[model samples]
Target: MSFEHVFKRIIEFMHADPCGNFRLMVGTDSQVHKRHTVFITGIVIQNEGKGVWACIKKVVVPRKMTQLHERISLELSLTEEIVGLFTEERKNELIEIVLPNLYKGATFTMEGHIDIGAGKRNKTSEFVKEMVTRMESMGVEPKIKPNAFVASSYANRYTK
Candidate 1:
């Protein structure tokens, strides 16, 4: 779907219950095949314990990406591309929905989930700092590994 349509849906979902806590998360994961690689970015809006509206954007690279660093970086780049679509004006629009209800515990957070883990056993550990820094620079809270369900779970599922 187009970015406009996605934004409209997100706004409508938030409007449905402005008083609820909300998390707008974006994540991307990839799978490599002999001929190419498939990347899937997941956009999810969860109204904490209430309900969620989600979507995914798919990109297929013409060549298989086998390098650990390259694939992970590309996944993050794809996620960033999607996050960039939500300009400050658009983000403020979302935050404005729950602004009035802040005193009542209503909240809104933006998160970027990187499909990397900091475990000694994980090869992606080496790049965690770089990816996290990028996300922070974009004004998004960064999540990795176990906490990054959108990337490791949601988006990963589609890569297959």
Candidate 2:
């Protein structure tokens, strides 16, 4: 109903099954006529085309709520469609395509759910380990720095 509420729901769906496709409500806020505010509901896919690339093949949003029960039916049908797309063979192909790209830097930053300066310690450790291994294989060294340190260094340059 509200922006924050909707955002919470989306996050919940994302966390429930980090590896599966899920639906959540999205909306935009705008004012019409001084005080008549309208929130347009929409949908967005999270973690789309991520690990294994098994995701919704397509999504259709209905603009009109002609029937009260139609919304539930649409949601159920869409969920099934998404599940069907994530076949085992597709998942294997996705991994084959993705893993090689990781070593080549072609998909290092393009994928991964890590924030600029936030994530679980285990993920960070694994990333560092993989990067070091990959770089060593290619005869290159990695450049490592804490995000806050980097940000402060840049900020100091502007102040001076």
Candidate 3:
């Protein structure tokens, strides 16, 4: 979908309950196939426990991506690309919706969910610091593994 359309939807969702807590999450995951690889990036807006509006953008590589590091980096790059679309002006617009309700406990957070984990059993563990640093530099809180449902779960489901 176009950025305008997605932004419209997000505004509508936040306007529904300006006093509600909201989280805007972006994540990407990739699946290598016999002939190609599919990458799916998920953009999710969760109004705390109230409701959510989400979408996915897909990118397909012409050849199988076998290098683990390369695949992981590509996934993160895709996620960052999406996050970058929400420029400061656009973010301030979203925040403006809830700004008045801040005194009522309203809050907003933007998170980048990396599919990698720090667990010793996970091969992606080795790259956690590098990826996490990249995400932190983006000015969004970074989440990995069990906490990164957008990349590991939502985006993963569509990579196939």
Candidate 4:
């Protein structure tokens, strides 16, 4: 579906009084093959009591992402590219219309869920802090690991 259409659907879902409350999340994940790679970007709206609503799109990169940092960068870049479709004015309109109190003093755009996280055996842990820092600098809120289901779960599924 078109990005604008998908975005509108998300806004509509948000305004539908979804079991009282909901959080909007977006992210990307990738699966590498010997000669190519597939990336999946997803948007997930988690309602307080009603079930979840989601959408996804997949694209292929000609080259494999063999390096950890390279993979992380591609995931982050793809997600950012998708999110770029959501203009600031429109996002604020949704916040004003449906999620006024939810974000309080925050910027209130879709939360980005990065696949990187902290842990001993998790190599992606090394990029967690750096990725969070960069995303914050760009005025975005980022989540990872257990809280990053939009990327680690939703996006990862279609990447396979």
Best by lDDT: 1
Residue 66 CA error for candidate 4 (Å)? 0.8
CA lDDT, every model vs. true structure: 0.97, 0.31, 0.96, 0.78
Per-residue lDDT tens digits for candidate 2, residues 47-155, read 4354221111223342443432343234323333333333455434433443544444322111111111224553334344543343234322222334322112322
**Candidate 4 whole-model C-alpha lDDT, 0 to 1:** 0.78
Q: What is the C-alpha lDDT profile of model 4 across 1-105, one tens digit per residue?
A: 887788788778766762246577779899999899998989887665676789998889898779989989888888787666667876776677555555443
lDDT of 3 by residue, 100-121 (tens): 9999999999999999999999
Clashes of each: 0, 0, 0, 0
Scored by Cα lDDT, where does model 3 land?
A: 0.96
Once model 1 is optimally superposed onto the true structure by TM-score, how far is the C-alpha of residue 28 displaced, in angstroms? 0.2
Q: How do the residues 1-160 of candidate 1 rate in per-residue lDDT, one tens digit apiece? A: 8999999999999999999999999999999999999999999999999989999999999998999899999999999999999899999999999999999999999999999999999999999999999999999999999999999999999998
- The reply for model 2, stretches above 4 Å from the true place, is 1-70, 105-160
**TM-score for all predictions?**
0.99, 0.24, 0.99, 0.87
